[model samples]
Target: MIPFFRKIRQKLLSRNKVTRYLVYALGEILLVVIGILIALQVNNWNEGRKQEKISDQTLQSLEEEINEARSNLEKIISFNERILELSNRFLAGELTKDSLENDPTQIFYLTTYAFTTLNFAITEQELSTERTILGRQSLNAKLRISLQDYLSMGDLEELLGNFWNNEVLPYFIEKKMMVVYNRFLKQESINKEDIQQIVNEEKFVNLVATTNSMNYQFLNLLKQLDKDLEEALVLIKEEEHD
Candidate 1:
């Protein structure tokens, strides 16, 4: 192609058609510029398509993550709810010592700490790194902020951990409250007398009440996180399809 164009230029120059040569040269330059522009535009289009596919994959991964988190959160919520219910019945004297002794797992339920399921570290890190791929700068920023706010509940989690370890567990051990459950675990016949004795104690009632209060607070936090995740999922889905 280059040799053909050079031949035309040489012919025009040999004929001393300087004016025509200049015109032909200018036309050739314009054509080259247009060709370069077309090539650049096609390359840009291919890159955009590749980026869009990647963005879709990222959003799909995030959606799956949110769903898993929601599932785990629901289980934790149900467990905490059961714990609260048992604690309330026990504190109100509605659950008899016989009932507790029959279901030694009731004791297990009341003492267990509430668990959290708000893990967005992977999601957050991916979003942060693929900010351009996600492309809703303001929405992405808002979701990141919301995720951080939920993660801040770690402080509450730590508080519960310290309370369980430093206060609750030690107190239960001293009172031999866990001994009944341990014996039950070994398939040993639970001493009904021990269960009755623990229930009648003021410290037993106090610890149960304290645990109930803490678990209730933790449950509320999980519920809030659930709502936020739902909202984020909605926005993300919209962005994905948009």
Candidate 2:
């Protein structure tokens, strides 16, 4: 192809067809420029396909993580709900000290605490970087909001832990109520007076009330997280089709 064009140019030059030769030279330059542009376009297209494939794989991994997080969240929510229900009953006098004394295991339930430990694929910083990579506005927004909600639960969990360590545990120790917990562990019968003391103590009741309130807040956040995860999954499914 090069030799053929060279021969044509040589013929035009030999004939001193200067004007036609200039036109032919310009045409060759135009063809070369067009070819370069076409090659760049093809390269760009291939690169785009590679990036899209990577984004799809990332989304799938995120979906799996979200489902696993949801499963864990469901179990935590159920456990805490039981604690809330039991605490409410005890506070309202629906659960008598006699009932608790019969089943020391019930004391274990009252003393138990719930803390948020849900995990997710998107971090605060990663969300922004992922937005640029994934190029899905709705999915990105959902992820950002969901992660914020999820991270905020950490504060509530920390508060609950501090309350248990500082207030509730101290009260138990000061009142010598640790004996009740020890009896629970040994599966031994609890002393009636100790049971009555725990059930009737004003400070203990207040502690249970405070924990119940925190549990309600934690449960609400978990429920919102569940909803956001569901929405995120839906968005991922849609993108898969696209």
What TM-scores do the predictions have? Answer: 0.82, 0.89
lDDT of 2 by residue, 17-93 (tens): 99999999999999999999999999999999888887877877788888898899889889888988898888789
> What CA root-mean-square deviation does each model show from the true structure?
3.0, 2.5
Q: Considering only N, C-alpha and C atoms within 3 Å, which residue pairs clash in candidate 2?
A: none
Error of 2 at 184 (Å): 4.9
Q: Tell me the whole-model lDDT of each prediction, alpha carbons only.
A: 0.78, 0.80
lDDT of 1 by residue, 58-135 (tens): 778778888888898899889889889998898888887778666655665676666675667657777768654466
Best by lDDT: 2
What pairs collide in candidate 1?
A: none
